[model samples]
Structures are given as C-alpha cells and as structure tokens.
Target chain A: MSLVMAGVVGALFGAGLLVSGMTQPAKVIGFLDVAGGWDPSLAFVMGGAVVVYGLAWRLVRARRREPWFDAAFHLPTRRDLDARLLGGAAIFGVGWGLGGLCPGPGLVAAGGGATTGLAFVAAMLVGLLAQRRFARG
Target chain B: MPTSWLLALGGGALIGAASALLFLTHGRIAGISGVLGGLLPPAAPDRAWRLAFLVGLVAAGVAGAVVAPSAIGASVRPLLAVVAAGLLVGFGTGLGSGCTSGHGVCGLSRGSPRSLAAVMTFMATGAATAFVAGVVS
Candidate 1:
C-alpha cells in the first residue's frame, strides 16, 4: 500500500514537472535567467507550494499532532549554520538552477520517462557521496 | 506558458502536499536532500525514515497517475542512466545533507542559512551542466 502510494505521488509530482515545463532544461534556465527573459513561473510554483505548506504546517501545529499519522512534528535541531550545511545547499542550488531537475523533478522525470533525468540523478548521487565522505558525527 | 505554468503550480502543490502530509503524520520533512543525507553510515534508525520517505515518494507518483490519467506522458529515459543517477543522488544526499527539495523548498523557506548556501551551489552547477550538455556538449 505504501509503496503504491509512493509511486502515485511520484507520478503526480512528475506530471506537474512536465506540466510546468520544468522537464525542459531551457524553461528552468529561463526562470533562473534573472536578467534575461526571466520566467517567473518558478516563483509562482514556489509560491503555490509554500502557501499550501504554510497552511498545512499551521494546521498540524494547532493539532499538536498530525491527524491520521503517528508522530509529533519536527523542526530542525542544529541551528549553528555550519559549513557542511552551507556547502551542500550551494551545490544543490547550482544543480537545480543548472539542470532544472532537482530531486523532486528528477523523481518525477524518472517516472515520466526522461533519460537526462538519469544523468541529473546520477550526478546528484555522486555529489551526495562526496559530501558524505566528510560527514560529521 | 500555460501548460508549464499550470503544471508547475499543480506539481508544486502535489509535491508540497505529499511532503506536508508526511511531515504532519510522521513529524518528518520530505526534503529528499535531508532524508538521503541522513542515510549515509546507514544503520537501523537512519534507514527507517529514509526508506519510508522514498517509499512514500514513489507511491505518490503511482497514485497521481491513476488519479489523473491524462497527465501521463509517453517518454522514456535510458533505464541504466536512471538507476545510475539514483545511486549518485544517494551519494550526493549523503554528503550535502539533503537533496533539492530538502534544501530548496523546506530548508530555504525555514531561513536555514545552510540550505540557502546549498541551493546556490547546485543551481549554478546545474546551469553549468545544462550549458555544457545542452549547448556545448
């Protein structure tokens, strides 16, 4: 059941990726262009997402527990703003801005049937490995 | 623009909804960046959330397809490449302490200085890759 649900989510997410034209690298780049023909779609996408999330988070917080779930809410524990976190974020941003296929879109693409997504996903993993080599206890 | 915009909005909602739901239920974030990041040096507890998160992600895709049959695209990337990318992302997540959504959506929104840094780096790298792959390579 859970596995099936996961696949369904990926498909929906991927469908969204396709619909948003994000699967096309050029579109993603356009959005990132800032000074060029800037595609404000990214902002809209983010806006829509954050808005929904904000509402969900508020609802969950009010309940003190997630309805239909088994755990308490979690917020970040380490607030030191360390180098590892910063470095990782930078790498991730570069990848997203460049490829237009961060983790979310990658999974969606994988489901949607894009081979380039494979490359993006692979490189992403390698990046992960490199980061782990320096993982702290 | 309409196809992409609508899709992007819907996609963002789906992605956000899944993550939000999971977090609300599990008290966890669905940032692939962080979940994969935590998996390195994997053991029992570390694997639990990581696996669950992934399972949930995949399940979501399947469900999305069934719910909205029209959204499915008829495209396929090389399977080998896709698997390779997944492995690479596994590694990247380990090092970076998160993947795109983990850092890009959840972390960045929360004002995590690290997520901001991570987002910057990857966006650049992705752009560099696209420039090379799409234009140069």
Candidate 2:
C-alpha cells in the first residue's frame, strides 16, 4: 500500500513538472535569468504549489496523530543555520542555473528521452555515491 | 500567454497534491533528492517505496510524451556542461540534504525557517549565476 501510494504521488508530481514546462531546461534557465530574457512561469508554478500544500498540510497535520503507513511524522527538526547548509545550497544554485535540472525534473526529463537529462542524472548519482563514501556523519 | 499561466498553476497544484498525498500517507517528506539518495546507500527496509515512487515519476514523462509531446521539451546543452551541472546538483543536494522539491516546495510549505533561508540563498544565487552567465556569453 505504501509503495502504491508512493508511485501514485510520484506520477502526479512528474506530470505536474511537465505541464509546468519544467522539463525544458531552457524554460527553467529563463526563469533564473533576471537580467536577461526572464520568464516568470516557474514562479507561478511555485506559488500555486505552495498555496495548495500550505492549506492541505495544515489540515492534515491538525487531525492526524500519525500517518497511515508510519508510526510518526518524519519531519525535519533542525533549526540552526549552518555553513554546510548555505554552502551546499549555493553550489546547488550554481548547478541549477548552469543546467536547469534539479533532482525531480532531471529524472522526469530523462524519462522523456533527453540525452542531457540522462547525463545529468548519471553524474548526480555518482555525486550521491561519492558523498556516502567520503562524508560519513 | 494566459495558457502558460494556467498550465503552470494547474501543474503546480498537482505537484502539491502529490506531495501532500505522500506526507499524509507515509508521514515522510516527498523530497526527491533524499529519496533517491537513500537508494544509493541502499536503506534496505525503505527501498521498495522509493523505487516505486521513482518508477512512477519516470512513467509520468513516458505518458506525457504520448499525450502531450510539446510539454516534454528536448534536452538543450552540451554534454560536458550537463555532467558538471549534475555533479554540482548531486553534491550540493546531498550536502544540503534536500533539493527544490524538498526545500523549496515541502520545506517552505511547512514554514521551516531553515528551508526559507535555503530557498532564498539558492534562488538568489541561481538567478545571479544565470544573469552573469548571460553577460559572459
């Protein structure tokens, strides 16, 4: 059941990404180009997502003691601001601007038969593997 | 165009719904980076759901190609740039512990202060990089 739910949710998320024009690296890059040919479509996508998630999350949190598949909510509890967070985010930002492929969209776009998207995901997997091997915390 | 806005909003809503479903059912954040990251190291007990989610995500693009090919844009970048971008994105997301879906979408919706900071930093940096890259090119 949990797997089924995960699959369903993921499918919806991927479809949303495509529909929002996020599969297009150029479109995503356009959104980030404030001083150039700027596109505000991605902003609208974020806005629409936040609004819905905010309302629905609140209602769900209010009534639920635990999730249907888990004993407790596995939310993040960290609050402190740290260099690791800032530096990592900065790096992520550079990559995002460079290629316009975040994790989710990268995978989705690869599924759409984009060679560059496949390249991105493959490299990303290497990065992830490297982190696990070298950075033990 | 107005249709762009409509699609953006509509697609975003679906993304939110997917996230919400995952959260409500599994008590876990729908963070793509984290989810995929876990698989690299092979967190045995939780692998099934993550794999299912990813499969569904890919299916979405495959389906989109058949139904709405225009929505699924082709890749547009040199191979080297794409690989480097992927490496940065992977490392950064691993270091930071989340990506756009996790931090920008789920974190912001949950009103996490840390996520807010991450979002601001990444957005600013992303925009700045794109703007500067444009100037350079």
Candidate 3:
C-alpha cells in the first residue's frame, strides 16, 4: 500500500514539474534571470499553491481524525537562524541558480529519465546519509 | 492554454492535492523536511508512517508518467552541478530544520511565524544563488 501511494505521489509531483516546465533546467534558469528574461511563472505557481494549501489545512484540521490515514501531525520547533540553516541556504541557492534542481524537482526530474537527476538523487542520498552519520542531539 | 501557465497550475495542483491527501489520510503535515527527518534514529514505532509517506511521494511520479506520456521527459542541468546542489540542500534542510514543503507550503499556510522566516530565507538564498551563478557562470 505504501509503495503504491509513493508511486502515485511521485508521479503527480513529477507531472506537476513537467506541466510547469520546472523539470527543465533552462526554464528555471529563465525565471531566475531577472534582467535578461524574468519569468514570474514559478512565483505565480507558488502563490496558487499557497492558497490551496491554506484552505486544505483547515479542512484537514477540522476532522478529529484525518480523512484517510492515521499519523501524528508534525511541524518544526527550531527557531534560531543558525549556521546549519544559513550555510545550507547558501548552498541550496547556489545549486538552484547554477543547477536549478532543488530536491523536489530534482526527484521529479530523475523519475522523468534525466541522467543528471540520477547524479542529483545519488548526491541527495549521500547528503541524507551524511547528515544521519553526523547528526547531533 | 499557455505552456508556462499549464506547468505552474499542474505542479501547484499536484503539490496542493498531495498536501491535502496527506493531511486527510494521515494527520501528518505533508512537509518533506519533517517526513525525511523521521529517518534519523531509534526508529520510531510509527516508522511505518514515514515509510508509507515516502513511498506515496514517489509512486505519484511513477504513475503520472504511465498516464501522462506527454509529461515525462529528460531534463537539463549537468550532473556534477546538481549533485553539489543536492549536498547543499541536504545540509540546508538540516540547518534550517525544514524545507520548502515544511515552511513555504505547510508552515506559512498554518500561520507559523518561523515558517515565514524560513521561507524568506529560502527565497532570498535562491535569488542570490541565481544572481551569482548568472554572473560567474
């Protein structure tokens, strides 16, 4: 059941990328180029998503229990803007501007058959693994 | 009708829908950062939820390709660059204690002040990253 769900979720996410042209790095680059050719399309997408998620959140919370599965709600507790956050954001930005492939879209790109995605995914896993190895309590 | 708009709507809808589904079925917030965080240690008895969440995420992409042939295709971005970017994000997520899903989508929607700060940091870093990459490379 989990496998089926993951596959479905991944597909929809990928399709979103494909449909939004986000899976294509050039498009992302184009959007990033403010002076040359500023494409605000991604921003619009972000806005729309924000609106939808806002409403859905309410509907979900209204129910005593969730509509489908059983699990606890999770949210971050950390508030300080520390080194990890600062440094990581710096690295992520560099990658986005240089590579235009963040984790979500990167995963979607790989699923779409981009060889480069394989590398990104591999590195992402490594990053995840590295964090696990060195995580502090 | 427009390709760009289509892309935005599609991605946004998928993400929003997935967010809603995750919220409905599981009481989980559908934030990627938190979802991945569960992998850390002592393996919570609720490990099944995390596993299921990740699986559904991937499956969504897989099924989309099968059904939406027009949506699946290779992408750009060099492999090495993307790998570096992935590592950066891994580190960033660790530091920030969340990612776009947790903050940009779920956090902000939930009226989380911290999420607002995190999202701001994410966009600022993203913008700066693009600036340097554009100028340097």
lDDT assessment of candidate 2: 0.86
lDDT of 1 by residue, B48-111 (tens): 5466555545444455455653343322324443454445445555556676666666766567
Candidate 3 C-alpha error for residue B35, in Å: 2.4
Deviating ranges (above 4 Å) for candidate 1: A1-15, A66-69, B1-3, B38-40, B43-49, B52-96, B108-137
Q: Give the candidates in order of DockQ, highest first.
A: 2, 3, 1
Residue-level lDDT of model 2, residues A72-119, one tens digit each, is 988999988898788888989988888888999899878877787789
> Residue A113, candidate 3: how far off, in angstroms?
3.0
Alpha carbon lDDT at A72, candidate 1: 49
Candidates 1 onward: DockQ, in order: 0.34, 0.80, 0.50
lDDT of 3 at B7: 66
Positional deviation of residue B117's Cα in model 3 after best superposition, in angstroms: 1.5
> If you assessed candidate 3 against the hidden native complex, which CAPRI class would it receive?
medium
Can you write out model 1's per-residue Cα lDDT over A1-137, one digit (the tens) per residue? 44344434434444444455555555666776565566767666666666677677667777774434444466776656666555554544444544455676565545434456545655666666655554643
Better of 2 and 3 by DockQ: 2
How do the residues B20-113 of candidate 3 rate in per-residue lDDT, one tens digit apiece?
Answer: 6666556566666556666656345566666666665555455555666455444444566677877877666756666766677777778877
What's the ranking of the predictions by TM-score, best on top?
2, 3, 1
Clashing pairs in 2: none
Instruction: Please give the TM-score that candidate 1 achieves against the real structure.
Output: 0.72
